[model samples]
Target: MSLLSGLPLQFSIDVSSLLNVVWLGSIFVFFIYGQRLQMYLIANDISRALNRLKIMRDKSRKEAIDYFTSSGKVTGDPTQRIDEFLDYVTIMPVDMDPRGVVEKVQHITNTRDERVRAEVSQIIPNLDPTKVSVAENILEIATSLNQIHKIVRHYYLLGKKTNSYMLLFQLQMIMPMVLQEADALVNAVDTFKLGQPVGDGIGPVIASRYMQNLPKQVVGKDTVMTVGEYKGRTLYVLKAEGPMGYVGEPGVAIQKLIEEMKVPLNAIIMVDAALKLEGEKTGEIAEGVGAAIGGIGVDKFKIEEVSSTHKIPVYAILVKQSILEAITVMRKEIAEASDKVQVLINRVIEEKTKEGDKVLLAGIGNTLGVGQ
Candidate 1:
């Protein structure tokens, strides 16, 4: 303060200017600090969301194991603890491709299914295959719901905290689809757990119920293709061999009947449930062209390929319902549609082809809680 202050002839300082500068510098630092604080908050929220996701995944995994524990007949012993194995299990995305995708998607689903069945077999040797399938479907849906909820919630919270209008806008835009899928997953799990017939299984039930009463023989892929005399045509009815829950590789079954059985199929008719748009009445019947199968398009691909190659005209008879109804408990309207569809099938067969001509009828859908 003595020597240095005196020597400051080279530099000059204004006290009032210095004070103002210090104030401005402080303000600048605080502005930067505030910006960093905002960034930290956004990042922390996202991190917390991801951590929540992990917790949900682990929780669902535990729940699945607990479900197996409660089913003594399935798990061999209900009291015994089983190690949780499905944590972070990878499920493949559905293939939306029109061609050359079934093998890839099927490999993933088939491998997982085999692994699940094997695990069940290992844990409770000689366990019923049907129970294992049910557990697998339920576990899959539970996992899906957990994933959807956590992801959508993460974005939702992030948008809210940051007040980012665009981010929130986009999230709002897509949340309906996310919610729809979650609802369907929840419905499917409930339907399976309740042992109730789902809307998707109605068409398959009719085909299965009718086929069971007829004198039938195995054609291909364990699909029972029966020849029945309808009007003048020898109607060949095909459905995935069931008493178990399966959508029965209808694509391959049709391929076998067409490419292998090589029966002179004059017309091809398929039946299944279809998703109706909002405002459309449930259980409404719609008849059109093409295979009425809902999946990753592998089965649809096979049907289209074979039908096109064989020059067989394809006719579709569909029962319309909401996505929830398709997976949830079958509604009374849908249950009644079974009889209506049966009559429609008979009329389609009678009108579509000539007498003495051979026709192929494939019932396509998950045959859960359905007989024959």
Candidate 2:
């Protein structure tokens, strides 16, 4: 045995060593305790935000039911409520107040933390200006900033306890989806260009203008038809007014147009608005090549069978809008679909409007409870 190993006659620790151990242990305890507290706080904030969102959604649903039963026309107020609910769902954070999160992030950025600041900044650019009310924007921005700050702070703490490389890899994988959604929201606001036409009795004006210049190749006067070519592809357009709850005629019109055009059925694309979850925004767009004819049983069955038989890529571009606001909202989806399919959503009254500049808009849905 060494001499030092046998030198325990003092039976006491050195004061300096005792102080050092106490200091280090205190720090470790504080760090662990602090992290737990922060996590709890974040969880509480998320719960509160979710509760608020649920309340808003419930209120919106009740309002929609009331309006539908009483007014007989789907009004803008109820639709706006739905839009608000969608916005809330899309933007809410998983663990914190988005505004507070963002503010905290901004602080870290100002303090010269480039790595974390970059991540926060990416989400910042994608926020939709139209979604939030002016007052709400102020509060939300602050909340998001703070939440982001907490995220970064938590991440820093985690790095001290574990390897940051794994955390960074996880973030890299998940951030893209979040960024894509944000981009979609921003693009929806920036490039959305429907509902711009204004005039008293504009619908009739549009209908009459279209009727006078109906294309010869298109069959039937009661059924107005327009033709256009987009991206070196030919397109046939048809529009008609039928009785309420009439979704059959549009399918018939499509068959007639297909026969007249002599184009292969497999190449055709169909676009229309669909009733979606209240969490989906009114003008949100989804693309899939399938028959868009709406209604239960026979009507939908026939259209689906026809498309399936022909091997046609029938694409449906559905706008997530209320069924009661079908006419206006469905029109918007048709226009968006046309744009997406690289076809024009406009009508040509004269041949002066190039074929590439026009697109076919089919207003398809149960016309039940529709019209002025």
Candidate 3:
């Protein structure tokens, strides 16, 4: 009382207590405000990046459509032109933290705002069974894997303990199986073998006894026969019939076809099965001139030299899959050859055949007996 004699009784509280309260309140306010600022910055950056990506994608799409419909006739080789468009589109800087984006979108979805949810769903790629049943199945498996990952992360966060050893051992065993399953799924998605049912109507025409009996020779198990009618056009379609690693061997058949068929060097198109990325929808096609066919020594080197020397336009159509699972993912640059190529995705070969399309269909992969 003597120390606070000059002040009112209410103002004679402990100086230390008063200072402590003031300091704590200031810190609390600062922390709350700082957190809000950080969230704002992150949201703004994500929004900007997404908007930029959309602009680039739309621009590329328009360019492609314009080129296709500009002239009454499809000119300048559709395959080459499509490839060029894809190269321009993929060059856009759209990659961000996929997980963070997913989380942000999911939060919006939970708000039950129909418009917002619908917009977010487009970016997320709906896991509807009708669109892609396999993708839906994989999503279910991913959910289980996510749970397992969480348990492992929790154990890791805790300091070394008795159960830690058991957890580590279990994680080690589970990882390989998870990886194997992922690989299998990616392979299944990448290697799209459209069933023979779709090929029924067209197959009879292409496989009629008259066409089958044409001048043909079994060039090392692969029947090389002349079919289509193109005067002075000796079209040789090289269908790889070997193991996965033997894509280069087909080049030999190709060289022989060039020499025997005497086909114009510029009219050649090398078709092969290619692995696509997760974002690439199945049946999406593009055309590019790239050396995707793998092999060592003479097989690969020779093809490159020959194609280059002839100044012939080479085109490729790659199927999409996960890069983590398949090392042979299709190259984006392959789509930027000349302005004459077109790479069509998610294309049904059977459907293409019905349209009277004379395509050099190259099933690029380890062709170890049909269903790989």
Q: lDDT (CA) for every model shown?
A: 0.72, 0.39, 0.37
Tell me the tens digit of each residue's lDDT in model 1 across 46-88: 4554455555555555556666766665545532323344333
Candidate number achieving the greatest lDDT relative to the actual structure: 1
Candidate 2 residue-wise lDDT, 1-372, digit = tens: 577775663335566678889999989987878656554554444444434434433443443334323333333334443333233322223335454553343344334323322322332333232211111222222233334434544653464357444554444345444333323322222111222111111122222233444452324322445665444334555443321212224555565555545445434444455666767765565656566655333335545655576555455545455433343223454334334333222312122233333234344443222221
Winner on lDDT (1 vs 2): 1
Q: Candidate 3's residue-wise lDDT over 183-215, tens digit each?
A: 443333332221111110111112222233355
Give model 2's TM-score versus the native structure: 0.33
Candidate 1 Cα outliers beyond 4 Å, as residue runs: 1-63, 73-101, 153-165, 215-222
lDDT of 2 at 95: 33
Superposed Cα RMSD, model 3: 20.8
Candidate 3 displacement at residue 181 in angstroms: 6.8
Q: What is the TM-score of each candidate against the true structure?
A: 0.75, 0.33, 0.34
